[model samples]
Target: MTPFVIVAPAGAGRVRLLRTGDDGLPFTGPDGSGLFGAAAAVTVEGSDLARTVAVLEQAHPRWVWDDTSRWYPSLLAAGVRVERCVDLRLSHAILRHSTLTQDSELAMSLPGVFTSVAQVGVPAPASAASIHTPAPHSTLFDDLDDLDELAPSSSAGFGATDPRHSDRIPRVNGTGGTGDTDGPELDAVTDETPELAGRDHSTEDPEPDTLEIAEFRRQRDAIRTATDPSRIALLVAAESAGSLVAAEMQHAGLPWSAALHDDLLTRLLGPRPPAPGIRPARLEELLASIRTLLDDPTVNPDSPAELVKSLRRAGLNVSSTRSWELKNVDHPAIPPLLEYKKLARLLTANGWNWVDTWVREGRFHPNYIPGGVVTGRWASEGGGALQLPKQVRSAVVADPGWKLVVADAAQLEPRILAALAGDRAMAAAGRDRDLYDGIVASGAVDTRAHAKVGMLGAMYGGTTGESGRMLPRLARAYPAAIKFVEDAARVGEAGAVVTTRLGRTSPRPSDAWQDVQDEAGADNATEAARSRARSAARSWGRFTRNFVVQGTAAEWALCWISAIRRRLWLLDASTLAPTARGGAAPTAPTTPTAPATDLRLEQRPHLAFFLHDEVMVHTPAHLAEAVAEELRDAAREAGRLIFGDAPVQFPVTVAIVDSYDQAK
Candidate 1:
C-alpha cells in the first residue's frame, strides 16, 4: 500500500488526490523526477471527497495536506476519520526555526510561502462571538450540520470498575503564581526573530498540486538528512499526529450537561439575571453587604478602584483588590468581597453566556491550536478550553452508559528533566512513586514540600527564600539534572539559543535585549544599567531554563495522544461488525446484514479534552478499563519513543469516573 496520498484543491469545487511511495515522496518516472499533473492525479468533486477519502483510507495512507484544520473538519462531519496525516503547516513551523535543520536549504532560505504559511493563515484565539458565528470559508466547519453525529451512543457495554491510581492537586484560583516574580507580570525580552516576523503568505487559491507535492518532498528530505534524523522524524510525526488529534477532539466535542452547569451556577451565584448587565440575586446581596460594611454604599464592588477606596475607608491597608492581596485583610467586608469576586468570575468566564456560545447540542467545541505556545504547548483560540475552571468541572458529565477516564501525569516536567538529562539518580527518584516523595526518601530534601520547592526552583530559576535555601541540597543530590538546566540558563543569559530534546528550537533573544546587555558592558556603564541588565538576563534565563523541559514534555504528550488515537481506533474497530467499519458492506451478500452506519467519532472511545499533562477520554462504560490501560500504555510508549532506555518513569494518575470533577 502507498504510504501517503496528497490531498490538494482542484479548480471548480473539486479536490485532487495523488498517491505517493512508501517514503512519502512523489512517484518517479523514467527520467527520475515526479510527474507534474494529470498523469499521476485523480480529481473528484468536493461533495464526493469524503467518500473517496473513506475508500482510499482503507490502505491506511497518511493523508498529506496543506492544513489539517482547513480539510479535516468537513471529513469528520461526514463521518470519516483518518488514522494519520502530514500537516505541512505545523512541520514547517518546527523545521525552519529548529537548530537540527539549520543547515538545510529550507531553513537557510529567505522566508517565503512556508514562513508566511505558518503565520498568516492560522485563526486568532477564539472569542465569545466567533464560537457562535459561522466559519468565514465555505469548505471549513460550515458543513458540520449533523449535530446528532456528536450525540451520545447506546449503552450496550459491560459495567466499568473504578480504579484510583494516584492523588490529584486541588483546583486553585487565579492562574498560580509565577516563580520568578510571584505574580503574572514578568519583564522579559520579546522574541522578534527575523525568520518569524512580518510577511504576507497570501497565495493563489489552491496552490498548484505540484507545489504541495514538491514541498512535502522537501520537508521529508530535510528530516531525513538532519543530524538526528530518527529523533527529528519521530518529533515531526508526533507533532503532526497532534494536529490530527486536536481536530478530532474539536469535532467530537466534550460531553457537557448544560442543565448541570446551570444548576451549579444558579446554586452558587443565584439564578441568571433577568436582563443583560444586571447582577444575579446573590451577587446583589453580597454587593449590598460589602458596600454597607465599607461605609460606601454606592461603591461598585466590581470596580477595583472603587473597591480599593472602600477597603481603605474600612480601615484596611490594601494596595489592590486581587484575591491574594485581599485574603489577608481581616475586615468583615473582606469575606463577602472575596465571595463576590469568586462568584463574579464564574459569571464572566463560564456562566450562562458561556454555555450559550460555546456549548451546542450538549457538546462543547473549543478551537484548539496545536503548538500554540512557543514551548509547543497547545492554546485554545477562544473558549478558554485550556483554562477549564474547577468551579464548573462538575458540569463535564459523561453520557449515560459511558465514563470519563481522566488521567494526569504526575510531576511531568520533573520526570521529563530526568529523561532529558539522562540522570539516573533523578530518574530513580521518580521510578515507581511520587517524584517528590522519592526525592525525600533519597535524602535530597527533608520533606516533600522541600523536594517540590527545590525542584520547582531548579527548573524555574527560583533563587530566593525557601526555594533558594533548598536548591543547594537538590543540586548536591542530582548534579546531572541540575547542571542540565543551569547550562541552558547560562546559554540563554548569553543571548544564545536552546533546543528541546526533539529539536524544537528556542527563539533568540530580541535585539532590544542584546542592546541592553551591550549597554551594561560599556566602560562607563551606570550601576542602574548594570542592575537592569542582570535582571533582564535572569528573566530570559528563567524562560530558557524551563523551555527545554516544557517543550520536551509537550512532545511526550503529543506522542501519548497519537498512540492513544491509533489504539482507540483499533479498540473501536474490534467492537464493531465488519460492515460497520468505515461504512463499507459486502458487494454480494449470502445472508441478510444489518444496515451499516458510518462509525462516527462519538460512537467509540475518543479523546474528549487535553491540557498540558492531563487528558479525559469519553468512552463506553465497559471499555473504561481498556481505555485506561491504553492511556497508560501509550504514556509508557511515549517515554520510550522520545527517550530510549531512559530510566525515568512517566506515571499517570488515572481516575475513571462518571463526571470530570469526580475524577479530580
Candidate 2:
C-alpha cells in the first residue's frame, strides 16, 4: 500500500490511478529517482473504479483528487468509502489566500480555474480584477425565491415566484449538476473529459494526470514554504477532511419525515393553496385582517414599499414593514401585520413547495459547499440546510430503529477566542461552566447579561450602550483577549490584513474603501469625506476583529468534525446493527440510484447534518451512547489539535432524540 493515490480522469468513463511513495509524490525522490516503483499507475474502467478504490482503501492511503464533490458521491453510491483524502480544490483555496503562503508561487500567481472554484462567491479585490475572472453567479435554488419576497416590482413583481420547474433530482454532493460533468463515468470513454471545475483542458499541453499532479505538488511546496508551516498544514488537512464530511453528509442526507412536514405546514399555514399564485387559507385570513385594519383592502403585504405606505396612511408612524420596527409602533394593524409576515415567511421559505422540492425518499439531500464562507463556515448550494428554522425542525425525524445524536459546542466562538489569545484569566473563567456565567463569577460584570454583551462588544466592535459600558470592565479584567482583537481591528483600520490562528487571511478592503481614505487625506477634502473614511475604517475594523475569532472557531469546528468522522469509522460494526439490541428490523429508504449495498451507510453512525458549531449524527439505536461519547471525545481532540493543551475547554451539549426539534 502506497502513502498516496492520485485519482485523475483518464478519459470519459475511465480514470488513471498513480501510486505515490511515502513522500506522497509519485516519480519524485530526493536522489532524483522515480518513486512510482513497479506498479506506477493503472487505468481502470469506470465500471471497475469503485471496486478498485474500495480495494485500495483497505490500506488507508490518503487519496488525492481534484474535487471531492465530483468523485466521492459516486463511490459512496457504489458502497465505497475512503477514510482520508487530499482535496486539491479546497486546499488550493486556503493556501492561495493565506498570508503565511503569500510569498509562495501558488499564492502569487494570477487567479485561474482553481481560484474560481475555491473562491466562488468571493468578490475580486480591485488590485486583482484585471487578472481574475469571476465565476458564474451561483445561488441556492432552495432559497432562490426567498429574495423575491422583497425584490423591487420590476425585478419580480407582486406575487412573483421562482419559475416553476420539476423537482430537482437528488444528486448527493451536487454530483449530477452541470459543474459535475467530471463525476463518475461507468461506461466507455466519451469523446472528451471535462477538466477541474467543469472546464475543458483539451488544448493544454499536459493531460489531466500531469496537471493534477503538478497543481498538487505546487500546493505542497507552498505549504512547506509557508511562514507557519505546521499550523498551515494542519489547517489544510482539516479543511480537506471537511470536504469529505460535507460530501458524505449530503450523501446520507438528513432523515426527514415528509408527512410530519406537511402536517406542521397545514396546521400553521392551512392546506396547500389549490393553485399557484394563491395564498394558503390561514395566510389569506391574516392578510384580510391586516388590510381591513389599515383601511387598504388592496394593499399587498408582500410588497415592502406598499406595506409601508399603507401603514403610514393608517396613521402608524412607521418607516418600514420590518417586524422589529413594527413591534415598536402603537397601531391596530401592527399585530395582524406581524402575524401575516411570520406566516408569509413560513409559506415562502419552507411551505409545501419547499417540502416537495428538498425532501425525497424520506431524506433532505442538500448540497453542502465546504469553506464557501470567507470565515471558513460552510454554505449550502440548493437546499436551505443551514437555516432549518425551529418551526420545521420537528419534521427532521430519525428512522424507527435509529436515533439522532445531536451535539453543539457551547460558547464556541468565545472559547476559541480564549484559546487563540491564551488569556488564562478568561480561559479560567470559562473552565467548566457557561462562559457568560463564568465571566460573571470572575467579577467581570454584575450579571451574565452584561458579561455576554461586553464580550460580544469586545469581539464585534460594539462601543455603544450596554455593551459599550461593559467593555471597560471586560478589558480591565482580560486585557490579553481584548487586546488581541483590538490589534486586529487596528490593523484592519489601517487597511492591513489579519490572519486567523491557522493562517486564513482576511481580504483587503476594496478599491472604493482605499479611495475614500485617500480623499480624506487630500487638501480639498471636506469633514464629510473624512467622516466617511472614519466610518468605513471602523466598519472594516469591526469585520477584521470578528474575522480572527470567527474564522478560527470555524477551524476548530472543522477539526472537531474531522475527528468525529475518524472515530466513527473505528466503532465496532456489530454494535451498529439495528437488531443488536433487539430494536425493530430496519427499513431501507429509497436512494437516487441503487447502491451496491443498501445498508452501507447504516453499517455505522455517520454525520447527517452540521452547522457552524452543531452536529447531528444518524446512528443505529444501539450505538447512540457510543456515538455521543465519540462526539465529546472529538470536541476535546479538536481543541488539542488547534490550541495544544490550552487551558480552554470546548464543551459539547449532547442530546439523543427521536427528532431534531426534540434535541433542542
Candidate 3:
C-alpha cells in the first residue's frame, strides 16, 4: 500500500505525528519536508494501516483563523483532537508565505480543515514546530501527562506562543540515539516530556475568593427570601386580573396620555369589563395550578420543563421549547401588572402619602445614581423625574414664583478619550472647546464626520483590514489615543479579564477556549482558524475597557446629585409657594414672612430623571440658582473623584427651563 505521509508547513519546526510507522518514524524530517520530498516513493505497511488511519482521523485539519485561546476547551469537550496546530503570530508572516511552495500545502489545506473541523469534532493541529524536542522523533501521546500540566499556564503574556517554552526547546539534548539512527526515537521525546513539565494545570488558581462577592450573594439570598411572600401575592394577583386588564387595554386602545397612577387607581376601584369578566376566576385557577406544580418538590423553579407544566395546567398550550416564543405575546395579566409597576414607581417618586410631609413648603427631593450604566453614565430614581418625557416637563412646576433650573454634560465620552489617551493633539483640539472641532482641525480626515467614524471605530474595534486602513494614519496623528486602544486589545487577547471601576469583572473565558488554544501551532491551518475566532472574542474585552470609562462617568453623575441636594437645603421657605394650577410658583423669595426653619440638604433638591452623562434635579423655584451652582460643583468634584486633578476640565451646560425637552 502507498505510504500516507503527513506533510506539515516548513516553519512548523518539529512535526510529531501521533502514529508511528513500522520503523517507528513520526516524520521523515524535522520540518516534515522529507516526507513530501519522498512522497511518490514511500509505501505503507498493511499492519500499520488502522493506526495510521486512526491518527489521520483524529488529527483532522483545524484552523485558528483568529485567536484560538477561548475555544480551546470547547474543542476538547466536543471530542475533536488536533495533531498539529499553527501559530503564525504575525500578519507579515502570513503575507510572506502567501506564495505557493512546499510550505504552501499548509494554506491549501486550511479551508478544508476549517470546514471539516467545524462540521466534525476534530480540529487541525496548530504549528509551533519551531520548538526543539528532546529527540529525533516524539509521539504526542508519550508526553500527554506532562503536556497537560504545561498547557494551562504556558499561554500567558503578550506573545501568542509561550516564550519560555519556545526558548527551552532548542537547548535540550535527546536521551535516545542521534537522529542519524533510522529507528523510532519516541522514547527520547517521552522521557523529556516530564522534564519539561512545570505547574499542575488542574490546581492552578481556584476562584470564588472575594469577600464582596460573598456579601453580595448573602444580600441577594436575603432579598429573595424576604420577598417571597410579596412575590406569591404578586403572582396570584397577576394571574387573576392580569388577563382582564390586557384584554381591556387591547380592546380600548388605552390612551398613552393617561397617567399610569390614574389608570391603576381606576382599575382598583372600577368594575370588571364584560369581555374579560372571568379573568378574576381564572387567576384563582392559575394559583391553584401553581400550588399543584410546586407540590412536586423535585420541580425546579428555573426549569423550563416545570414552567411548561404549570402553563399547561393553566390551559396554555406551552412546552419547554415553546416557552420563549410565548413570552412576546400580550398575555392577559401583562397590562394590569405593567400598570401596577408604573403606579408603584410614581408613588415611590412622589414619596407616597408622605408627599405632604416630605415636600418642604412646596418642593420634593430625589436621589441620583452615577456610573449606573457600566459606561460612565448617570441614572435617577424617585423624584429624579427627569427621566419623564419632555411633553410632561410642565408637570414639574416651579414653586409659586420660581423657575426650574437644569444642567447636563455635553460630549462627555470624547473628553474622556482625550484624558485617557493623553493625546496632546486631540487634547489641543478639545482645549477650551468642543471635541468634534478638534478632530476637524487635525486634517487627518476631511471632516469631523470622517474623524468621528474613525475615532469611534478605533475605540470600538471596528474597521479592520481595508475599512480600517485609515486607522494607522489616525493613530499616527493621535498616537496616545491609538496606544490606548492597542494596549486594551493586547490585554484582551491575553485572556486577562477587564472590569469596571466598581469591581464588575468581565466573565472568564470558557473551557472551549483553552482547547482551541491548545490546538494552535505555527504550521497548523486549523490552529490558524481557531486563532481567528479568539481574536473575535477580544472584541468584548475592548468594549469593557470603554465600559470602565463610561461606568466611572456614571459615578460622577451620582456625586453631582449629592452635591446639588446639599445646596437645595439652604433655600428659605419663602422661596416655595403653591401656584393657582396646583403647582408651585415660577420664582419666589428665599425667605418667607414667617420665622426660618432649619432643613437638611437631603430634604431639598430631589432627583427626577437620569440619562447618560446628564442629570435632572427638582428644586423649589427660589433655589434654582443655588441648585444650578451645586450641579456645576458636583460635576467638577465627580471628575476629580475619578481621574484625579490632572488639570482635566469637565464643563457642564446648565439651563433653567419649564419643560424637560427644553432642558436637553
Candidate 4:
C-alpha cells in the first residue's frame, strides 16, 4: 500500500482516488507516473462509491480528503469508516492565519478562498462580518483566477523530472527566509476535481480542486519552516481528528426520549395549551397575576412597550419592562412577570413544535459546526445542541442498559494560563483544587468570588467595578499569567494578530476599526469618531485577550475529544442487538431512526454529546468505568500534547449516571 491515498472529487459530484509516493506527494496524472503513481476513479453511482471505499479501507491507508464532514457522512451512511484523513479545509484555515507561517507567501496571495460551507449560502453569523480566518487550500475546488491557469510540474520545483527520482522532493528555503519562487499553481492540481466544505462546489462559481496538491505541499512546507513544528503538526492532526469525531458524533445520533420530554414539558408548561402560538396555562396564570397586581388588565405582558406603558400609568415609574428595571420600581407585578417571561421563553424556544421539528425518531441530530465560533468554540446550526435547556435534560437519557460517562475539564482556561505563562506560583495554587480557591489560598484575592471575577475580568478585559479592584492583586500575585493576557490585549489594541498556543490565530481588527482609528487621528475628527475608535479598540482587545485562552482551551478540548475518540475505537465492539424504538406519546410523538446494525449504542461506548469543556459518552453499564478512565487519560494526554511537560493540570469532573441530569 502507498503511504497516502487521496480521495478527491473528480467532477460533477464524482470522486477519484490517487496514490501518492512514500513522501505523500499526490499523483501527477491518470496513468502511473514516476512522480505520483496509479489512479482509480469512482462516480457516485448508487452503492458503488461505498463498495469501492470499503475495499480501499482494508489497506489502512491514510485518506487525504477535503472537509471531513462534507464527504465522510455519505461514506458513513454507506457504513464505510476510514482509519485517518487529512482535512485540507480545516488545516488550511490553521496554517494561513498562524503566526508561525506569516512568512509563507501562500498565506498572503491566496485569501478569501477558505470559507466553510456553513459560511457559504447560509446566513452568516454576525461575528463573520468582523472576524476573518485564513485562506483556502486549492486542492479540490475550481474557479479562482489566482489559483487557475497552470500546473506545478517538476520543473516548477516540486520533484525533479528524472524517472528514477523516487527520493526527489521539493526544496524549501528554511532557517534563513522564504524563497522567491512563484509557488506551485493551485489550478494545476489533478483534473477538475474540487472538494469543498459541507456541500458540493457551486457550478456558477466553482473553485476547482486544482491547487489541492500544491496547497497540501505548501502547508507541509510551511510546517517544516514553522518555529514549533511538533506543536503545529500535532495541532493540525488533532484538529483533523476532531473533524472526524464531529462527523461521527452527528451521524451516531444521541438517543432522545420523546415521551419523557413531553412529560417534562407538560409538567412545566401546563399541557402545551390548546391554541397554537399561545402561552401555556401556568404561564397564562402568571401573566394574569402580574396584570392584576399592576392594576392593568389590558397591559399585554408579552409586549415590552405595552407593559412599560401600563406600569407607568399605574404610577410604578418604570422605564422599561426589563426584570431588573421593573424590580427597582417597587412593583408587585415584577416577580410573577419575570417568572412568566422565563417559562414563556422555554415554551417558545424548545416547546412541542421545536421538539417535533428537531427531535426525530428519538434522536436530536443537530448539525455541529466545528470551529464555528471565532474563538474556536463549536456552534450548532440546528436543534440548539449547545443550548439544550436544563428543563429538558431528562429527554437526553441514555438507552436502557447503558450509562452516561460525563466529564468536564475543571478550570481549563486558568490552568492553561498557568502552563502557557509557566507561572509556577499559579500552577501550585491550582494543584489538586479549584483555580479560584487556589487564587484565594495564595492571598491574591479576599474570596473565591473575587478570585474568579478577577480572572474573568483579566481574560475578558473587564476594567471596572469589583474586577478592576481585584486586578491589581492578581497581577501582583501572578504577573506572568496576567501579563500573558495583558500582552495579547496590547497587541490587539494595536490592530495586530495574536495566536493561540497551537497556532489558531485571533483575527486582525476589521477595516472599519482602522477607519475609526484614522478618523480619531485626523484633525477634523468628531468626538463620536474618537469614542467609536476607543470602544472598537477596547472591544477587539477583549476579544484577543480571551482569544488566546479560549482558543487554546478549544485546542485542548479538540485534543481531549480526539484522544477519547481514538481510544474508544480501540475497545472491543459490543455484540448486543439493536433495541426497539420508543417516543410516541401524544404530547411527544417521535419515530427515532433505529440502529442500522446489530451494534446497539447502549452496548458499545460512544460519544453522544460534547459542549465546550464537557463531554458525555454513552456506554454499556459494564464499560462505564472504562469510558470514565479514558476520559481522564484523554484529558491528561491533551495537556501533555499541548503543553509538553508543563506541570499544570487539566483535571476533569467525572460522573457515571443513567441520565445527563444525574451526571451534573
TM-score of each: 0.82, 0.83, 0.42, 0.79
Ranking by lDDT: 2, 1, 4, 3
Q: Per-candidate RMSD vs. true structure?
A: 15.3, 13.6, 28.4, 11.4
> Which segments of model 1 are wrong by more than 4 Å?
22-25, 28-38, 116-210, 313-315, 572-598
Q: Residues 158-235, candidate 4: write the lDDT tens digits.
A: 111111111111121121111112433222232322321122222221233445555666666766665444445656
Residue 465 displacement (Å), model 1: 2.1
Q: How many backbone clashes can be found in candidate 4? A: 21
Model 2 regions lying over 4 Å from their true place: 21-24, 27-39, 117-209, 578-599
**What lDDT score goes with residue 323 in model 1?**
94
Model 3 agreement with the true structure over 232-313: per-residue lDDT tens digits: 1111111112112112112211112123333442343332224432233333334344445435333222346765665555
Clashes of each: 3, 0, 105, 21
Model 2: weakest 10-residue lDDT segment is 126-135
Off by over 4 Å in 4: 21-24, 27-46, 116-211, 316-329, 524-529, 574-603
What lDDT score goes with residue 503 in model 3? Answer: 20
lDDT winner between 1 and 4, please give it.
1
lDDT of 2: 0.72
| Model 2 lDDT tens row, 425-489 | 98889888999999999888999989988899999999999999999999898887887788778
Top model by lDDT, which number? Answer: 2
